[model samples]
Target chain A: MSTEANRLPTATLPGGHLDCTGCTHRTDDWKTGPTATFLGLLLFIVYSTAAAFQGEHYMYENYLSPMYSPVVFTQLERTVTTPEGETLKVAIPGAAPVEHAWFGLKPDAWPEWLPFSPAFLILAFPGAFRFTCYYYRKAYYRSFWANPIGCAVGPFRRGLYRGETHLLLFQNLHRYALYFAIVFIGILYYDAYMGFFRHGEFGVGLGSIVLLLNATFLACYTFGCHSFRHLVGGRLNWFSKSPLAHALWKRASFLNERHMFFAWLSLFWVGFTDFFVRATSMGWIPDISTWG
Target chain B: MAERTFEIWRGDRSGGEFKEYTEEVDEGMVVLDMLHRIQARQANDLSIRWNCKAGKCGSCSMEINGMPRLACMTRMNQLPAEGKIKVQPMKTFPLIKDLVTDVSWNYRQNERIRPFKPPAPDSDGKYRFQQADADRVQEFRKCIECFLCQNTCHVLRDHRKQEHFVGPRFMIRVASLEMHPLDTDDRIPDLKNEFGSGWCNITRCCTEVCPESINITDNGIIPMKERVVDRYYDPVARILRAITGGGKKLPTA
Candidate 1:
């Protein structure tokens, strides 16, 4: 008897149990359904289409009213001086009382290797496309493709690739990527610091500083990631006796644990910070004070 | 006093579907409690998977009304009685009978991660570790292997990219051990190339659904990604790699 059966006694489910919703007695193996995967494909289609068309309806925004912080949506209108010197009202919002992203004056693309800017977007495309994934193939097959609901493949019982190739011979990119991620975080920190006191006063703003900190944490966590270490040489199957190498690895792993936490906090905070800035610029939140 | 409806799945691998039944309900009952009622008073041989119904073992994860949740912890009162509760197996793994999936593969992946072997201990066999050092790793070990995060992640839940990506849950496991201050194995390269660590776009659905509140992406996945970048893309490191014939010569622990 499997652990599951041992834990459960024979019982009747009239109104039924959640775990037994689609269950039967064939507990030893798994099957698949391409139809379920197709359904998942369909869901993606709907989602992507919605995303494409959701760009902007006149570039207007939803913001809280100064008078009623959480309960109201107020429209922000802004005027900016054009390169030709005439100030005009642009439906798009996002400008502090005296500050602006100056997007109209921004460069289209800097370089293919620059981080977060249009540069990295263009550069990362090749890698992204090359690594088109298969994370939920089993689920899609069962849930959406209308295929038989079961495991696509059984447990592994073979050689290196058959299991997780411990002594990964050619997988070093993950570690390399980590250092650059750290550097990226450092640059973001610099950007935040530059913005922090650039105005000669101790407070150019803490908003950017906070963003920098979030970036810093994400960068640190990403550097400490296991994937990178794996690529670097985590699978050195013959080096079990080497003390120093093992020591660095333990240290890396330690940081990586903290990495997971900061990675998330930063991901969420970045989105929120972006939204907050946009709201403040568009006249949503009046004068976000310079205090920390 | 009240009759509740259950939508149970009634088919096997070849083909099957949801079969509903209505029965009397009770107070302070959980979804698992209802299923037990069904199995005892209704279907005598019905198969369901669970253990430690207190939500500790993670054996009872299922789609409760379209959301990934622990059925044992789901209170019937919290659900809308106006509709039939939809329960399904975790979409990311292979389903066995119904809600049970072939999560055994995850366990195998867990083993693939080099087990923790501390660096040479000081003289004697015993070693000492500071509480501050072990605190964070212990926190990550709280995961019960529920795979709910894997089930709800759009990448694994909708996109079939397992061949190229290991889900956030496994990444969390790797991170947990890697973070152990005394662990003596390197896992970064395997994380990048073999495990397909870069596939996570950080949507963080895994982080969102984690019952343990572990930050799979921020604390685990991104850090791994950053390390990968450091190895291959960082100019100085790349030059060093070229000069040193790759950095694999370094020993772990």
Candidate 2:
């Protein structure tokens, strides 16, 4: 040990705490991660919101947009007599023909004020699932809510950090939302199956592949859920006795590890699937099909 | 050898200021190595708390350049080459002296959590379980009581909700016991009220700073939160339990 004379005088801290939030001493460009997350999530929100509002261009041939799957009710296909005395059917370009709708036509009791978009009926279930997702809660909390902005960084809002307890108590409903999402996956898979057939003819098309990939991606995301993982095996006290649940939990854990990747990928693919169906319906892109 | 400057905070509970010291850095030197050099050559009274300098002990946790990191694990090469390194005690905990903190609060939090209560052994006196059962709880056991997750948690660091929230370190402790294959204690009530699991916003700062790379947010905390929901908030689960008379009934205190 050195002599006492070698000791330096104790320095006084300005405040008890270092106030290191947003400190310049941090060498890493920490802002980049949250910024990228913000931009990516914002892009998805904007595009999905616009697509959900667009009532038309959701179906072409036998292919349906994942956004508008299980099409509840649709407008009737219009018909007019040509100059040559031939009756020709006309649909809002790319809109699903009346016969394709599960329910023949838009319900007469539908409130006029509410928009007639099939996407409006179904988006909320999957939306709630993704919104309350354990990974997405982290993503949006940092990127959107600016909860501490980034690790050790100062937050945009300071006082009354209730943190999912008060209004966000709804977030606990994520497990319930998982049930709805599982059902949606089944419906989407059915739509994918329908994509394989155009007017009763079994054939493959670009649209068929798009719908198939959309359903598959959504399935991966839904199955990889944190709550799903818990339900599968986490609730159990003994994995040795429940071999099936143990295996399922292992698979879910594997998928849960990549939940963030699948979350973003599926979000992007869902949007792209809608855009593809819309474009194909509008005749902007021809359906590359074996039928053709 | 290359000369480097370190701005080290030196003070007690009253206050502190960063004092700069220059030292020669060798190849493969960690931040702790440089601090040891400064202690030996310059400030003989320089204070630091460390054990098992290989990063397992987790005693040398400090804020290096504003990020909570283990000094023993933070290699000098990983830091930026140009700037002076800033070293300070963890902000969430009260500073005792220099880099040593009054980490007694963490121990107190650990004390509050109930220990694991497993079922009685079989007739052969063997507590046997499958490797898969052990594997789930094993991930949480890897935690070395680093308190890095606790330090980096915004609920404790920024909001200072220590009275309510048990911080990430203890949350995982509870997760390990709660998810154990044989352990059958019901801490869910305590987790909701006393431990304040809801205070965690799932910002994932704790997960990000974990040296053990434990999936604290996803695998640990969220699962616990879902359990809380099942007991307290989920009407569907409540209805199912009512109809079936089949769910893990909360143990009476």
Which lDDT values do the candidates have, in the order given? Answer: 0.52, 0.83
Put down candidate 1 lDDT per residue, A164-248, tens digits, no spaces.
1233222334334444555555555654554555345556444555555655655555656565444443433323444455556
True contacts kept of each: 0.04, 0.48
Candidate that would win on TM-score: 2
lDDT string, candidate 1, B6-64, tens digits: 66665444444566656677998998888778878877666678999898999988766
Q: Which stretches of candidate 1 lie over 4 Å from their true place?
A: A1-292, B240-253
lDDT digits (tens) for residues B68-108 of candidate 2: 89999999999999878888888888888889887889999
DockQ of 2: 0.47
**Which candidate number would show the highest lDDT if scored against the true structure?**
2
lDDT of 2 at A49: 89
Q: Identify the candidate with maximal DockQ.
A: 2
How big is the positional error of residue A154 in model 1, measured in Å on the Cα after superposition? 25
